[model samples]
Target: MRSQENGPIKIDGIDKMILNAFMENANIPVSQLAKDLGISNTAVHQRIKKLETSGVIDSTKVIVNPTVLGYSTMSFVGVFMNKPSSYKLVLNSLEEIPEVIEAHFTTGNYGIFLKILCRDNLHLMNVLNQKIQQIEGVTRTETIISLEQPIVRQIKL
Candidate 1:
């Protein structure tokens, strides 16, 4: 089931249907899923278990509303490292900042890109100045604040 080349996992039709249903609602009851799919509850449960064990289903978590939680500012930071050898150090430093929600090693102008969530502009500034800039290898950063997110959804199956 694991691929060294990061290839797609082998999934049949039923697995696709099951994945689509779960993606629509992760909290859906297994019995209801089974009924809707015209399959036994035990069969559905076994399939789900297999999917989880095989790393097909990584995790099921509640998606919290960041706005409701007072995280109003979403910003992306493009990190420029001093040298290639500094990547690991910069990544370790980035992880210590709680505001950093996501980080990716990219292929373009920036060595690393980060998605940060903050309560306000001031919070974002503090994170950039006091936290991110403190990392030795991080020579500079370019940030763009998100005004709105019109579309956000998982990929089609």
Candidate 2:
């Protein structure tokens, strides 16, 4: 149940209800959840603690909107590394760049896939040329700019 890679945790009906409520609004007060579930506030608090200790719930974070920050460009870049051994080095370099929001090692033609956010196309180009492409082991990259994102959601519980 505690293994993250083994899929969902082993949880009871009450845990499921608490999780669903948390997933909808991470900041929801435990007292509110307790009242809604017809349970004591202490019970709700203990359930939350258990969920965290058991790894069912990770850290709660505020989700920020890129558009509001004037970062209008979102690009997916497939990076081709010079060698497989260079992955660690490239990843370290990518992590240093503020524009590279997310990176995933994959089993496809490319070595790594990157999600980058920028102020505009020009900013993206600057980041690609001055930062990403300048890495020692980066051979090439193919980037696709997202025109629109219609669907974005967390996994269904």
TM-scores, each model vs. reference: 0.94, 0.93
Model 1 CA deviation exceeding 4 Å by range: 1-7
How displaced is residue 7 in candidate 2, in Å? Answer: 7.9
Alpha-carbon shift of residue 136 in model 2 (angstroms): 0.7
Off by over 4 Å in 2: 1-8
Residues 67-137, candidate 1, lDDT per residue (tens digit)? 99999999999999999899999999899899999999999999999999999999999999999988999
Model 1: lDDT equals 0.92
Q: What's the true lDDT of residue 85 in model 1?
A: 91
Candidate 2 pairs with clashing backbones: none
Give the Cα error of residue 132 in candidate 2, in Å. 0.6
